[model samples]
Target chain A: EKSSNIENYFRESRLEEFLKLTKVTNSYGIFTAHHLNDHIETFLMKITRGSGLQGMEGIKEFIELNGLKIYRPLIQIPKHILLKFCYKNNILPNYDYTNNSNAYSRNRIRNNIIPEFEKINPNFLESINRITKIISQINNKEKIRLFNEFEKLEPNYEENNISFSRIIFNDLPEFDKKLILKNNSEKLSSGTFMENKHLDYIIEKSYSKSNNFSLDLPGPIKLIATKKRITIEKLFEIDFQ
Target chain B: EKSSNIENYFRESRLEEFLKLTKVTNSYGIFTAHHLNDHIETFLMKITRGSGLQGMEGIKEFIELNGLKIYRPLIQIPKHILLKFCYKNNILPNYDYTNNSNAYSRNRIRNNIIPEFEKINPNFLESINRITKIISQINNKEKIRLFNEFEKLEPNYEENNISFSRIIFNDLPEFDKKLILKNNSEKLSSGTFMENKHLDYIIEKSYSKSNNFSLDLPGPIKLIATKKRITIEKLFEIDFQ
Candidate 1:
């Protein structure tokens, strides 16, 4: 129901799509034709933008959207092959001129970046997919590990907020601390933009004696810390989906 | 001193230049004219080729090479800016034809890919530098943290290798396990290409009930597991240098 040619606005629209699709569709997924080039571009984008393991994971084949699913079967298929298939079958497809044009970040990545990457290693895209597949398997196990670890942390929750003591958090491993911060902030934004810098800052402050401070994070959420606890909540009353 | 016309081989040669320069230089430093673009290319290469946090940390202004140092004072300056200065000052520089050719991976990335990334995010290069700066700071702390953590691991040793028991290794966090493996393997290769995949393999096998297996890893290192311990050693005696 929404589209944005601009890169900055694209994420905003995508975040809200889960909610929109919930109203219109049955439990079945809304299928997309996003192919290999798109996935490769995403990998490149995450790298260029300085993302972590999650960012490197690229796009998922299936994403749970409320009760519905967003499925992309052609994600692993190369765009050239898809074009070849269309051409061989004598099917005329509408060309998106914007893709050919260098308007969007993703378009620029696909058109300009990936070809150069291909020249480096022809199998580069597939290699990234290989890592993605392995990491996804590891993450499946890690997801369960995180929830179980979170139980040890003993978080307290109100209707709109969750808080954890800094005492135990400061002593945890760096990744576990990151997982706890990410988990605490996940529900604050559907856009999923809470970044490492924000989490790092809060984690840093938690160790210091500074009693009270609130940091405005990327989800546009607020992470407020008092003498003993840290809490994250949405600053605005907007539902994602 | 070995120099690579193509950036791909350049980094490979750069890795081992430490030992090579140890033989030649009189303990001062070797300087190069690598500007900001080259640094950016290395960052891009590391990302496309699937690197971890250290890869994103990019080039250091100074690198310790035995008694000598590899220095790049002009690393912060962009190529075009250097060219502009050269033009304004009437400085004659030798023209390199290979840069115009699409034969090298780094050249292709620099000449083709970067300009396209510029179209997407004008601040993209600077943004990466900013991350590099921040990560470098954290990595400094992390380096100390790793050593401190390693001390607690209390590794055992024999004639050929340092060994950690699976019972204790399996109990450690995933990243701690990775740090342990990496710390142990750092002596194996000065090239620094032992990736997460290789480490993950050894870590995975360390926990499994099955023992007495040897895993051949990238960097040509072997992770040999006995009933009680896991050992990582250079699979071959071939010096990459």
Candidate 2:
């Protein structure tokens, strides 16, 4: 039942459909076992495709998708370790056949990739695991401080849109300013991260205008730059509600 | 020593530097992470940058980075969990201060973004997590299978480069073709994973019966495409010894 739904989730929803139905059973959050291998792949994908800071972040441990809380605890572990664990435990896990064919970009990583590191340094995986943990810890602290500040800085949302005062945002710590923009934008659309260029455009636009201005995102979110603040709103007929 | 090295690694290497190093690693059958968040980020970043399918892939968990290994394990995590964990643990994590400053495009995701779904369904994170985990597992299994197959279809690398035989790659799988391209083009000087536009240009150039074929990546990697073979070489001084 789960696998079928999982396959359908990919083929059908484009990741948003599931976002609509899930409910945070309590004040609870979601979780996953992400590890160093995952982080390297993500970084490669983003940088290879010409991504900015967010892409460079390795892997995020948590995010808000549609009101649900998502989390990853195993990001520090290596797949080999997990494989080793499974082997030691006599757990014969399911192997996806498609990975062997390399029809997908990711399969190339598992099949045609990953082994060369064992040759370069037997402990490469362990080293990366350590590095990622440090990175994760540092990033975690920053996230908390930023989120606290974000909760305090209320974005003025009017007429189904939200914005922040340019003057107020400028007064904030540079870090806070960026956090405000990211979190506030999410209020408009879930599961979306803008690019460095686009964020630059937004910042550039935000400073020059007081009138209503907007940037289009993947979801039904619009980033509106206003005279007093920046607001995000859902366009007409695209009721996220 | 390790802590200092880790910090130095972070300081000395920017995203671009890592990309340069990883390309060389790819030739040796390394893999990087290409998970859910990465997929999402890649998809968004590509659209913003107006890139192609390759760009949409973001980072992959297992990639051949010039024979080095790069992996990601946290792509399945949601941002909120990282945030909450830091908050609850009082971790005081480090953040990309620029993210809060709105200096880049991704700040939008960090700030005024993706919060509405919380107000609506409340389980958005859980839903995306579910999908990400399922897909990630499938990807993992596929990776192992593909690796075994790759070992069987190994092309003899002459002069530390694979002979460019479309027949050798075409029959394996589409993903294998990408892997072969990735493998041969490891090292910034080897011309692997260059721009999609440049890839097409190279392919177009390939159609012509030109014995002297050459392509340059952003850095020192150069590809001299011959009528019957593609020679991969580093155009810059690399410390292999």
Candidate 3:
């Protein structure tokens, strides 16, 4: 019941949907055991796709998505350690079939990329965790705190579209700029949605006198900068909201 | 002529030696072709080893190091493009024997980790380049400018030591605080010196009324904070300097 149809086929939104669906019957949000492997793969994927600093920061320990709080408690513990724990407790771990196959880019990264990274530096995973922790520390400090304060502005990410108030987002600092533009804008093909420059261009354009201008991103993502709203949508997605 | 004994063994200070040795009869600074692949590999290695934002910015187009300008003009051009350019221009590129074998951690990253990244995103090189360019743009703007101003404090990275002004660094904005603490302070065994937590801890300690307090980093790197200075040095480096 936790694995919904949307999550089974795709990665992004289904987790929140599943959590919300579960919340109807259960109490609080869904707590998960998304281990270090998951976090590391996400990190690998982020850099590969040319993600900005915010995107490269793997996963939050607690994420409020779609009004549902999804908590990942075992984010720091590695898969091997968990397996060892299971062994010590005399409990057999379930081998998820999905994890074994290369059905998704994530699986490929987990099965292939991380191993190669391991070969380069035996403590590579630990190093990534240290960096992740450091980035988390930074986020916890002044910049992220200030950025979070500006969350009063309601930014919406619908099915195939992303929209936020143009005037509100324009004059903010770069950290806030990157935060809002991070996941809210993305292209369907290749990796990385819009880079810092792309996001900066869009933000800069939103303030200009031209009321009707659209910027084309790689892989059919179009950012339409109307007078009041800056919207990002997939050009190929026929049912875009 | 290219791979000097200094460069063959060392990664940091030796580059200056190689340049100086080469500049015996040369007119000005030594320019080399450090292609995009090299840059990308370095970047991957940097973040994997808990590098800060400054460290993750792989190679500089023009770096003035140790009274010498080491210029890498083809840094923006990808390896494949350079290879194609070589083929079209009828120029035979010299094969660096070091790059061929996985004798070094960097070689392993270049030969192993990057290929896996490529598999995840075919245009991963372009993505890295895009991110690097974006970072360059950000650096061009503000954070980097402020950080560069702080560069007047000559932070030395000796065999077992790294030292800069404790008083000046303590009162900096977070960006400058982050920059100085990055490469200038690192564990002697690993890639990255200090994480954000370590920096924050040091910065926090610097302001305290205590005259002499010492904080130990990961393993051996000790940040000794005195009345007038904060010094970082490996615990085991025999020579005190």
Return the top candidate by lDDT: 1
**Model 2 ranges off by over 4 Å:** A1-36, A50-57, A60-64, A71-74, A84-92, A95-104, A108-113, A144-162, A170-176, A187-190, A234-241, B1-241
lDDT of 3 by residue, A1-241 (tens): 1233223234433554676578777867888778888888887777687775665569778876545678999998899999999999999987656443334788778777778778767777888887676566655663555546446445665776877777787777765666666555532222234656777787677767888888776444677877777787755422222
Listed in order, each prediction's TM-score against the native is 0.62, 0.40, 0.69
Which tens-of-lDDT digit does each residue in B44-81 have in candidate 1?
Answer: 77666766556666788887632356799988888889
lDDT of 2: 0.51
Better of 1 and 3 by TM-score: 3
**Which lDDT value does model 2 have at B170?**
35
- The candidate scoring highest on DockQ is 3
lDDT of 1: 0.68
Query: Per-residue lDDT for B55-113 in model 2, tens only?
Result: 33445555544434455665565556666788999988665452232134443332322
Which has the greatest TM-score? 3
Supply the TM-score for candidate 2.
Answer: 0.40
Residue-by-residue lDDT tens digits, candidate 1, A104-145? 677677667777787787777876776567556656766798
Q: What digit string (tens of lDDT, one per residue) describes model 2 on residues A1-241?
A: 3343334334325335434444423336556566677776665444344443344456777766545666877766777788899899999966545323213545444343334333334554554444334335534656787767655556556655665566666567544566567666655554345544666677667666447677786444577665776666765433222
| Global lDDT scores for all candidate models | 0.68, 0.51, 0.67
Candidate fnat values, all: 0.38, 0.00, 0.65
Q: Considering the two chains of model 3, state its CAPRI-style docking category.
A: acceptable
Q: Which whole-number lDDT from 0 to 100 does residue A172 have in model 2?
A: 74
